[model samples]
Target: MAFPLMKRYFDPWLVRIRNLLKAAQGRPMALVVLFSLSLLNLSSEWPSNMGRPAFVGALDEAVPDSFRTARQLLFDQYQRHFPRIPTAQPVTIVEIDEETLATVGQWPWPRNRLAGLIDAVAALKPLAIGLDIYMPEPDQTSPDKVAANLPETAAALAAALRALPSHEAILARSLRAAPTILGAAALDHATDTASTDLRSAPVLVHGTDPLDSLRRYDYVLASLPELQEAAHGQAMLSVTLEQGVVRHIPLIMGLRDKVVPGLPMEMLRLATGSSAIDVFADGSGVQAVGVADVQVPTQPGGDIWLHFASIRSTLSRYVSARDILKGTVDPQRIRDKLVLVGLTGTGTTDMRTTPLGELVPGIEIQAQVIETIFEGRFLRRPTWLKWAESAFIMAFGLLIIWYVPRTQSRLAVFLRAVPKGSAVLGVSLHLLNVLFCFFIFVRLGLLVDAASIFIILSAVMGCFFAPALLRGDDPIKTQARDAQGREDENDRTGKAPGP
Candidate 1:
């Protein structure tokens, strides 16, 4: 009686297991298992291929460019939809706008006119004034040029010209009197020449050979020697573009074996009365650049990821050059403010594409960089982020392999198997990964690409289920076979089969 009871208890489960094995034994099912395992193996190699160009390119293409655009749009929308931290530090832009050009005349205005504008802004006692314009050559409207054209009174005119200072000299005097930071450009051409008279700001390095790993440039195009000497500080205005968009700005750039500060960095130093910039690095590369008490985190090559705010929302930040020069504007507006003087008139060719869309001024880009650093809110991808992503992909892939097969087997045995279940699981996993990445990006300002992992998950599901769904023996056939076997067993035992 005990033996009969034990047999009754184990017989049904044993039969189900045997049917599951029979359904999963055909060539079609074998191929599915083989393909799924192959994908698992391929996924294990993804981390090592992270640095390869082909692998990187493929990962970039995995998500459509439209998705990137949409991501940016979403970022903009969120910033607009939410309330931001109120800033106590005032930063202003003295723009050479269309209205200013129409009022003060077109660009390349007489050096005296520019000198007057500087003097007017200086009177307000701003924190620091940065010139985004480059003065590479002598002014065309100088006293000497005017004297040379008046040949009829050449002898007397030469004496008058000598008595009156050159336009450049007047501008230099104004620059020396005011708090000014001059901007320069980095060039890729090896033969490019920079002003030897201009002095570079002092840099103090805190690690072994940090400059060796920085983004190196062949030469720099700086301002005129006299002007550079007169300015309080000099900074490189070089900005690297990514796919025609301004995403990251370099805080320090390498020039002929020497490291130089970028415009935003130098301006901050001058504003805070810091004499030298302190760069901290390790074997990996530069870790941070410090000015006074503020330290900014940077990439290995001294690039900082910008957290952009919409220019339209910050329109009050700009003050027309004409208004500043005419003394009609309120002095309280710019008093103790950090002022950036740059050209923003139409056709200036200084516009850039930002996350907010096209036609952003290059000056605003630098302003945003300074703002981001000052706020200490940056977007960064930690060194271990990729490792975390790779580990996640591997673990999830293995889970699917283990869990999905058992699920399919059980479903097939119950005559309830369907392809939709696997497809639904794959899509749900994809959506969960997307939501996780989005949360990290918005909350912590970390960007981790989940597209590659999604691809791996989808592929694994497809390989595991496609063959089984298409060519494997139907669940109905398995059910029929089990019923017929039960009937034959009952006939041999001389009993009636159950309905």
Candidate 2:
């Protein structure tokens, strides 16, 4: 009696489950699995929604890293196909190249020589002059050094050398006289964490304190104290490079909890005569940095995405330091133009890789940033864009979930034509997705993670087809089975089977 009662209570639920499983044997089962997997992929907080992870959380980090490399390659191809033309901006690089080194003496030329260069550039009446070179120590070849190195027997010569002005003083005087913006570097491993009283240009904040949210450094390596005081502005020259490429440049960074402008930002500020920069930020991070009336957008840590100009075009923008010193360069190029002084000499380690795959001077990277800001052609990925991307992924995933099952059902009904039809449909869908992703990227300047999307699509197709192949339910196997059944019947009837 007890056994009968138990069977009556549980038998209906067990039967329903069995019937449901039987109904989901082929196409329906595949669809249900694909949909569930898609939901798991899209709803998760993984770096990218490629597909449902075979094992959750274990491969999460590796997937995004691989996708990033692929995305970078896609971006590189995009840039190659649609290279940016150089804008007619009045920004020039006064490069100390191999030619300049051969013409002028080797680098570490006396500070007086740099002073002379400054004076010459100032005479051209540039809008602003930025030294992408840093002066961490006093000139070693100064007259004071010579005097210290001399013996007592050469007292008269030492006296003459002592009477001569120090190289630092001369450079400081030039800095004071010209519209010069000095360069400084932020040190990550600096032993000194105490903030030095470096002369930083005034930067006023409008919305919220963006200092705490910016990339911070332990210490700053600035120009000589006198030079810093005399210069129109002082800013950081440290650049951040990722995977050997410079894609973004920091416009504002923190050193020992103090905010400092980048070399390019200071040059712009000095050029526009903006005494104080107005930074706008909120809980999200830095939105934009303003100088006078012009506003420039930035990434979370005050870095600007660089839309690098073609390398061929950048060649003309370089004015050799030798020419600048010899007065051979055209004044029109310097007059009212922003001049960046940096070393591009052969032995210099200032070379950096750009999106174009060519190595360029670090100063050129800064110049690109400044020029981009001036032109207001910033590449930005707004906060809302991620949500839009997620929506796209979800929508596409759903479409695949809905379409693949129907395709499987149709293929089963027309098993004889399944091989040819599946091939055509699969190729078409894959190509369509590729074109769609590329179009959105090129047209809208949005990255849609094509790699991840493709992975999801492939996963869906594999799930739908793998079971059929394994169960001998594929088109060729089904036809073979039917032929074998007819042959068996003919043999049982003692008649020869027909082909």
Candidate 3:
């Protein structure tokens, strides 16, 4: 048969097959195929986009660029539609900002000043106070400052924790007393630590190879030995940032075969007094729990999903250290509040630029995560989620075959024709997967990555329409044959050929 004739005859059948595949009942088979593909892709990171521009363009009119209000709208919308109400173990912040400098001191303010800040926040008598700041090493000027001032700070901070003696020992220590998590970013540039401040380091949360990722990091070790000597608990606030957004913070990483916890989990242990933290990540995703003794096996790496909280909600509630210092804010309000040491300064430039080029506040991001942990609401995408994604695609692909050719409405037609279906679908899969990791069941802890979903769509399209385009190349020959058949029918009907 001629190429055009062959294609013209075959195109419709292939399209029908696509519809049939969508209508396929047992999708677990497809899941098995896709899941096997995922397993073969054992690399730890999501595949990079070769045509990132095209992918971005697909989202151009869809996802607008607006950090301040856009991000808020997204969270609120997600909360409303998805409604993962966070069970926040409430905490406050003593942001080290310009104003904080005015009230407290400069960037690397004295250990005594941090001691006072601890005392002030300690007065709240929270379940625990966590320092997001780091104290990896000791201070030069005060060789014994962290150690020396720790006792003094404990003395003053003790006043607050006295009522709750356990709170004092566990919650009031500056990197020493409070359930502590230190911030440390792996140095991005191999520069001298000349102007380096050990207060807090930027962190990179996720990537394929930890060494290959250009995700920035900063060291948060303490500058005072005295400070280092007095803490009850300590862990890294390590981040695996993407583009620039601080997305996932690994609860722990492999270093000389040592197991560690991230900042939030460590502090959670202090706040809740739980000795065991169950870490879960199988085929679906990762989950962290503050049980007395967790039984999940250790992988070579880990990153706890960020349980996000809305920024407006976070800022409306949290008062800065500087505000508390000047008495602009009443201490009574913060009394019994769990406070976090963070950075939300105007000039802080503590902004992470996302793939979408949106600059988000690092502190606000942490606040959201804190709320996620506290609320027990996490986004989860299990291995089953990928199967679910494949199912959705197949189902929709069938619907497209049925509905697209018959539907007359351009609006409906546009919806079917565009990639929007894939976006909505992809986002749904990830949201379910990630959120589930933070809050409830960490089932099928597998990372499907966005690439898998894209691949599914491509496969469906290639199967469905490659013939349609080929058949269109020879419309004349196809139409001629179609006319000849119609003529035969007309001759049998004893009538002229229809126009």
Candidate 4:
């Protein structure tokens, strides 16, 4: 009796709900609901939190990190396959490979040996030499230092060794003679309070103060005073990584509260003999970095999106240090090129993975940066792309929602003849959107988040189609219902139903 009463009361309400759902699948109301959902999606992705309420943080967290990560991975795949033919051949690497280490003994080779290496490279007259090595402390291998550690039994020998000229002094003379840029390491933790001398290129700021937009360092690990003062310039030998891959290198960064150029930027400055670097910025942050006549578009924090060439490309030449030291280097190879000196030995710690899946020396990345800037082939992720993606998801989702319901309406008789035709139409539109994003990336070098667009649309399609799937109605269901009604009529008339 209770079941009968419950069904009697709920059946009318269930019919009303089914009727409401069918109406929602039509115009005006469907568009409004979809538009409202699209706005909610866009609200969560607002770039800045300035004008929003407190709950936005919660909403943002609701969007899984996996989605953003997948989006980045998709972009990485695009870059990996993209063909980038470098137009400029401005950088060459002087690699200290396994052969060099074996021939010249292990790394931290006596500063006197390094002095000879510098002299050899300088004799060829490269445009500028960048030493991508950090010499934080005085050389312990210096004769004087070695003598100081000797036992009293070797007093005479110690005295003889100490009498020889200091190793750093010899290296300093070589550095003074060559146009060299010494590499400095960036540190996050503060060290000595007394400020040591730091060399920063003159930066002309055009828009807002960029101090806040730059990557900050508490201290800089610079070379010894003698060698640092002798070098033409000192720059940070640091790189910025995303997902453990070297994708962008900072052109300029903050060190000890002062702006200093990165290794690549300093190399560019010295090669072009630029007096200062011009930085253009706005409310959005740094827009570009200009050195002499070469201006590079940069991300907000003075980082350029690196356009990495294929590993097989010989655009940038690499000369072994062993060859350069042995006087076998061709003058044409080093002449007028910005030479970067770094270790690429098997056991070296500076090896980093590139987007191309090669483990390259950190110095090679710096060379790539210089080449990218010189060629002006930049990959840009514009600020407006997010809004455009949001709009696309809304418009495309609304279109599909409108199209799906029309497939069953008398107004779309052709569509009604096809079984589940709306799904097929929606999938085609999705494929077109994917191809459109690919074309934009290939033709314009624009980085669009196609993954997010796909995710949003897929969710919208799933939700819109879910109710109909749950109802389990089709041409077969309508025929079965008609047969059941006939059987009921036959049973009421006391006539046996025939199959």
Alpha carbon lDDT of residue 56, candidate 3? 44
- How do the residues 96-161 of candidate 3 rate in per-residue lDDT, one tens digit apiece? 776776666567654556666666666556656666664444443343333344566476554543
> What tens-digit string does per-residue lDDT give for candidate 1 at 1-499?
9999998998787666444444543323434544443334333333332344564445445533523454445444433443234254457899999999999898878998999999999999998999988878778789887877776757897779867989989999999999999888887774335532336789899986677668887767787888888999999888888667777799998887788899888988898999999899877778899899989988777887677777765678889999988888888878888899999999974889875564698998888888777777887755566667656766776666555544235643443445445445557768888777767777887766565566555665554444334435443454445556766898899996543
RMSD, one per candidate, in order: 11.1, 9.9, 13.2, 7.5
lDDT of 3: 0.47
Candidate 4, 21: how far from true, in Å? 8.7
Alpha-carbon local distance difference test for all models? 0.73, 0.74, 0.47, 0.76
Each model's TM-score?
Answer: 0.77, 0.80, 0.55, 0.82
Best-first order by lDDT:
4, 2, 1, 3
Candidate 3, 372: how far from true, in Å? 1.0
Using lDDT as the yardstick, the better of models 3 and 4 is 4
The segments of candidate 1 whose C-alpha lies over 4 angstroms from its true place after superposition are: 1-89, 190-198, 407-419, 465-499
In candidate 1 the C-alpha lDDT for residue 290 amounts to 89
Q: Pick the candidate with the highest lDDT.
A: 4
Candidate 2 lDDT at 183 equals 83
